[model samples]
Target: MTKEIWLNLPVKDVEASKAFFTAIGFTPKPDQSAPGERACFQAGKSIIMLFPDATLKQFNGGLGVNDTSTTSQMMISFDAETKEEIDELADKVKKAGGNVFSEPSEVQGWMYGFAFADLDGHRWNGLYMDFSKMK
Candidate 1:
């Protein structure tokens, strides 16, 4: 069985990606830092592997990169403990040079959430579930 999971993503600039993730509260692992290859960032138990554009191309057998400006392959979601935490994370995302893709809003009157795009144009969703109302 696998003990850990990793999300591999393509990035234009490794340094900038590292900085952006760091500013948004992720810690990069020094061991994964390498030249023209990859950088690993940890978000709680999740590991995000950021690969250079060229390296990622090679890893994908030279497939053309996706147009992240208009489309996304996935949306990484983070669960917040409270609505306040969701708001705070949105602020943090903006402070880290990211843009809020969607404003915080209620979901079916059962949850609150917001979406943001990282410096590399990856979409992330921050959500807070109202468990009290679920009962």
Candidate 2:
């Protein structure tokens, strides 16, 4: 049973990446390598590590890590407590320089959410589920 998770991502500019996420309510964590080359940000309790291209290249067996600015490798999600929260996050995503590709809306009658992409074009979503609507 895993208790924690960490997502490591590559960024073209660490400072810019940090500012973008922090603008959207994420907090920076102190424990990270290389001040200008790496950063650690927290989304709820999960840790997301941002590393420069040079550092990330050393980790992926020394080759080929595609940039999400062109193609997506994954879409990370966040859990929202209510429908309003989902909508709020969607706004923040755009205001923080991310794109809200899918506006917040009801889905399958029980879930409400929106999809967006970060400055680097990494996709993400914030979803709210109503258990009462489950069959």
RMSD of each: 1.8, 1.6
Model 2: weakest 10-residue lDDT segment is 30-39
Residues 25-67 of candidate 1: C-alpha lDDT, one tens digit per residue: 7888979888556789887678999998778888889997777
Clashing pairs in 2: none
Badly placed stretches (over 4 Å) of model 1 are none
Computed on alpha carbons, the lDDT of every model, listed in order, comes to 0.85, 0.84
Q: Which ten residues in a row have the lowest lDDT in candidate 1?
A: 35-44
Tell me the tens digit of each residue's lDDT in model 2 across 31-111. 664578888988887999998888888998898677676788888988888898888778887888888999999888888
- Listed in order, each prediction's TM-score against the native is 0.88, 0.90
Q: What TM-score does candidate 1 reach?
A: 0.88
lDDT of 1 at 28: 82
